[model samples]
Target: MNATQRTNERPGIEKNRIIRIENGKKAYLPLLLLADEQEDMIDRYLERGEMFVLEDGDRALAGVVVSDEGDGVLEIKNLAVIPAHQKKGLGRRMIGFIADRYRDRFHTLLVGTGDSPMTVPFYEKCGFARSHVVKDFFLDNYDHPIIEDGVRLRDMIYFKKSI
Candidate 1:
């Protein structure tokens, strides 16, 4: 994997152009689960310095909310590729870009998820496997339960890869 260390320090909290998202806009509701009806917490993470955005072509296509737990663990708190662009390998391409850019630097990469059919499979297809599950994940962490197609979620799954 090719790794580039841009001498520039990463953007600062106030200068971050990327914002955290709890969900895509309303029209995208069917494609993802809204972690909360109110997006404040996610916004705060963005403002406090923990989110990363990926762009393809001229538009932003995906993001990953990450927290550095240790030099060995980089947690991908959230990840999504807009529904309009699914199934075209854009998601895979972005993941490859990020993994290539960070694999040698970080010992491992982690991704977490609440109960969601679409997201779980997407992660699996990207070469992730279930590492563990946290009960009441959404209840304990999110202000509201994530519901999609009227199904409520209460657990979160973790996926990991050695980069």
Candidate 2:
């Protein structure tokens, strides 16, 4: 599938905008939940972190949340693209946007995701390298067992990319 890249101009597509949502971000809970799953778990970070929505024309295609982790580190707490919009490079574009948007303010961009066949490779493909893993992160943080791509996720794999 062909993906869109950021550039000065494009034809036949509405201008895409990434907007930082400062208040009432809870309205995108359904979209956010696609990434984090648990509402209470999301609540732990939602209020304190910053949220952004990717909008094209009148459609909101994806959402991401980030938080300052201090020490020149910025963490991608959650990222989710609507099911219908997945695999269209929107997610990667959001990542690239985040990188450019924060390159001056942060040294490293980190994301924690499940160790599943479906996820780790995607992050690696997005220029992120395996940094570390937190054992039992899913089991310890979530109230229920998490599984993806037919595999049970027991650890949280952390990936990092230097800006």
Candidate 3:
């Protein structure tokens, strides 16, 4: 893939890097940049073939993670904003778009993330609240040491929202 073509996937004004996922290879490049553990979930989602992507110009800004969690609960599997794009409200917009997918079908949406001081408020701002805490979140899920800004990681507080 040409660097310019690959990077320029986001359309229109060059800030909306949006792409509808048709296959694993297409989603991999964008997801790899967004996710901390890379695109490990690509194959499983590809098997079901229910994935999509959003980007800013040539840069992949964010991706919404939707997965079947049984009984009409769609889990927001892994929404990641590349480090460069963290402070922007793009994460919120992408999340709203993802949550809108269930509409009236799904009863609730579940998301789990680190329990550190930083993440709890971010989720709260996203309209999610503390439902429960899971021990050793990073150790269980991540492939490598998940040191964020030199702090050792473990456990996660799960949040849920009804729509």
Candidate 4:
């Protein structure tokens, strides 16, 4: 795929552009950290995952990292939109782009995120269903407490969507 491509014509989403980052994935660390928090955890999959960024001219509005997890499964390791651009349908558009682009190659799209009120609903709204849970994922993996939407995160909630 090209490094940059125009998104499909969807009301309120046509103006955005999604770029595939072929190098320097670390350059977007600030945005990546918004979703995953810890750098080390992101490092675990950063090099292996394919990254795409939603941008408006020179500014990166959002980004996502997806890795093929074998057996026709593609996993979203990180996804984040800038605070100023959140809830504007950018993240949803990114997800839609990924699904459309990989529909032929992958059977399922998976994302494992903290059990936070803020994130789970967004995935659910984007057509993902609760698949499984890894208890104490935050406690066990993170060096510090991971909290979101006023809730202390403990488990890693996995969500799945069939492409």
Instruction: Please name the candidate that would achieve the greatest lDDT relative to the true structure.
Output: 4
lDDT of 3 by residue, 1-163 (tens): 8998878565445557556665554545555434445355444454453455676555666776577778977777666677677878877877787677676788887887675565667778989867888898678776777665477678876899887
Tens digit per residue, CA lDDT, model 1, 1-163? 2345554335443431343444433333322233334455455444433544554433556655566778677776545666676678766765665677667768777887766786788788988888999899777777766786577878878988777
Between candidates 2 and 4, name the one with more favorable lDDT. 4
Relative to the true structure, candidate 2 reaches a TM of: 0.89
lDDT of each: 0.61, 0.89, 0.67, 0.92
lDDT of 1 at 142: 71
The 10-residue segment of model 1 with minimum total lDDT is: 27-36
Query: Which portions of model 4 miss their true places by more than 4 Å?
Result: 1-15
| Candidate 2, lDDT over the whole model | 0.89
lDDT, candidate 4, 64-155, per-residue tens:
99999999999999999999999999999999999999999999999998887789899999999999999999999999988898889998
List, in order, the clash count of every candidate structure. 0, 0, 4, 0
* lDDT for position 124 in model 4: 93
How well does each candidate superpose onto the true structure, as a TM-score? 0.68, 0.89, 0.74, 0.90
Candidate 3 TM-score versus the reference: 0.74
Q: After superposition, which runs of candidate 2 have C-alpha atoms over 4 Å from their true positions?
A: 1-14
